[model samples]
Target: MDEDSSERRWEDMELDILVRIFKTFNIIELTSGISRVCSTWRLACSEPMLWKTLDLGLLKSNYIKIPAAPYVWVSDSSDKRLMRLLKVALGLSRGTITCLIFHYDLYLKDEHLIYTAERCPRLKQLVLPAWNQITKGGICKAIRIWQDLESMTMPSIVHPPYIMEEIGKSCKNFTELKLMGPCDVLFASTLATWLPKLKVLSLRCTVLTKEALILILDSMMHLEVLNISHCVLREVPEPPAPKRVLLELDETIIGKASRLREFYTCLEDSCLMSQRTKADEGLIRWYKYEEWLWRMDEVSSLSVAMEQHVEVGGGGSIVPS
Candidate 1:
């Protein structure tokens, strides 16, 4: 080894400069790399501040051989090793780690959850896909420890009563919430009542009936924005009213185009009532494609003739452009 060249390497990166370099790596990676460069480097890498924000997703593929899907993740020894590694990672720098993202399956045991709750006492934001994994008791326990929790994005929350009453009641500063997938009238209404101070609520691809929708709207009157995008809606069957109405409120408000200021389904089904023409007995052709368009054009003309602008029933607000 060239002593002169080796000594010169310290000019660019002294002990402090090397600690800064070591801080960029994760707890596991930094420990291994620094341990190789004699005992002194190992001591420097063990600095608690160097190991904040432990991202378990980064170590998903290589260390654990964990699959993206739950069904595919092999419940073998390697998986146990991965969980142990997570625990060790958490243990190494609990005080320093303010942010921890596990972009993988949370098939964690109860002890693990308790350990995690203990370690990440000040965890402010959490994003977990399977809320079912964490029970109402577990949630309450975690929140009891973590008073600083501000944001959470969980999918398919089964225990709303516990979360709304217990956890939310405890966490005074809690603001943002994003619950994804199917949620019924009961759950949504409960949330509106519980989280009165909630600023942002995102029901991801969740379906809501018109009646259920109204209940929510009335409850969350302070709501600034609402997103029901990509959500399903089952049409409510109603007794046929007058010959026609101007516009359908339900259709316009939730469905169809973006410029929808006022929403209702009034224009009628263009397909069912379409004109069918028969030129001769022998020819099986009904109406030409262009002929149907012409018929719709006539319907539009008739609708226009009835009312240049139809006033909504019960003196409701007029339609917007």
Candidate 2:
């Protein structure tokens, strides 16, 4: 056989075959490795199926806490690296990304958020856990651009009305939401006012007030699923009276939630998760515990898939170069 006939060129491979091979590659290899080999490989890397969900769940910022607004100070190098990763990933995605996932520690600035929003115009689901660096205006702007957004896993904010109103006004298809922090009266009331039609909500491992819980159960008549597993449920009496911690839901609360398709509540003191939530002051220190603990949710739609882990440079680590 002739030497040329015996040897096959990767460039000469079919696009379908290349795409199938590319499926095994993680975000790093797809962004930094194969795409630069040649124009054919570049075209394969740009395949729409390859860019549907950009999960940066492994990437985190190196930062220190400061006594100022946006209190955490992320290193300049970390910010630049994130920008580079976003530029490459979004450029190759070609606006086909429907779901975007970020690590709970990957704090992003206004510039990073807006840049992603502008590029991912078709984004339907977003799981962004940290809002320390992002401002209300910044998040609102991003939400407006994501007009098709259907679900989100976000950190609880001081003022929830702005973001809720933005989602209500922009995302008509919005149905699911998960808050990773304490839910107060204002936050619960804001959700009821702006997103009464919300279907699924998860306040797993967070502090949920009795008033907030009751308000949510009563107001969100269209709610199909509610998860408050491992939550620190509290009851506040009339002014001047101290708030009391409740170990279990009362008959009234349970009856009110009976109308929902799924209502998850775990208040057993023996349960490790329940203990952890109580010990940590309603916020589970996920890093110290199992990483999967934070991602666990009784509501299927609100849970993050563990399979989307991004491998960096042939290693198990998710550090992007």
Candidate 3:
């Protein structure tokens, strides 16, 4: 309100300082003043580095420009609105975005997903959930573009072998993977083979049988934390007497856990009472089978009898020196 205050405000106008200050504004503020200001301010506002990350989630949210500016979708330019944002950010950042996270609910078109993967060449970590149009190959190509990527999460993955192979070949820094679908043995084997440093793996292999489960863990020699709570086949007949959280296949896999630290095989109540009964009966049968197995030089078939013994710790392939 005072004359001195007004004079001081004008005196504080510094072009160099404005450039740094412009970096913090959202898309709207940046564009509104970027070209309108003098060359110095315009250059600062238009810096590609400021646009390295184009988060379309903001468009879905309340923050980003509502119905992005018209010019963003130039009729002649191949890059449309969101695509322009992608290209602009790509140009500005000049390979600065290390992580790109698409909102879980985002329904991307195949074209959108492909363009994004093509543009974000330096992206290191990507998290996309429920992007129905995205296929195994698209993800593989996008991830392969980032050599230093370390983490990824996606939902409803159909096949993981090809994707895992791409990761193995391109991103050696990768160590963490989370998938929210059927965790088959083949996919697990591929991942285990490629990710040597991997320590955490979460697969929704809940209902998988013991045979498939064992095969999955065969390759994860360095796995530490495993959460199979959502697994379908892990329903224990009854809780153990001491009652510690262990999976149905815990006995078979734990021995080969060269670097494992934690394993969770919690289950729902679908098979609660029946599970306990089966577990109790299964425990007794296992010991007898183990005794019989040990009587022979080598057990040929892994029958229920041998399987029972294997489950109850009667005998294992851990031959002592």
Q: Backbone clashes in each candidate structure, one number apiece? A: 8, 0, 15
Candidate 3, 78-156: lDDT as tens digits: 2234454544444444556665655433445556666766666666656664456566666666666677877666664
- The local lDDT score (0 to 100) that residue 90 gets in candidate 3 is 49
Cα lDDT, all candidates: 0.48, 0.86, 0.50
Model 2 bad stretches (over 4 Å): 2-4, 60-72, 308-321
Go through the candidates in order and give the C-alpha RMSD of each one to the true structure: 18.8, 3.3, 19.1
Question: Which stretches in model 1 have alpha-carbon errors above 4 Å?
Answer: 1-16, 19-28, 31-52, 59-79, 206-212, 234-321
Question: Among all windows of ten consecutive residues in candidate 3, which has the lowest summed lDDT?
Answer: 295-304
Determine the backbone clash count of candidate 1: 8
Write one digit per residue (lDDT tens) for candidate 1, span 129-156.
4434455667677778777777665555
lDDT of 2: 0.86
Candidate 2 residue lDDT tens string, 103-195: 776788999999999999999989998878888889999999999999999997887888999999999999999999999899999999999
Instruction: Give the least accurate 10-residue stretch of model 1, judged by summed lDDT.
Output: 299-308
- Which TM-score value belongs to model 3? 0.56
Error of 1 at 102 (Å): 2.3
Q: How many angstroms is residue 28 displaced in model 3 relative to the true structure, after the best TM-score fit? A: 7.1
| Better by lDDT, candidate 3 or 1 | 3
Strongest candidate by lDDT = 2
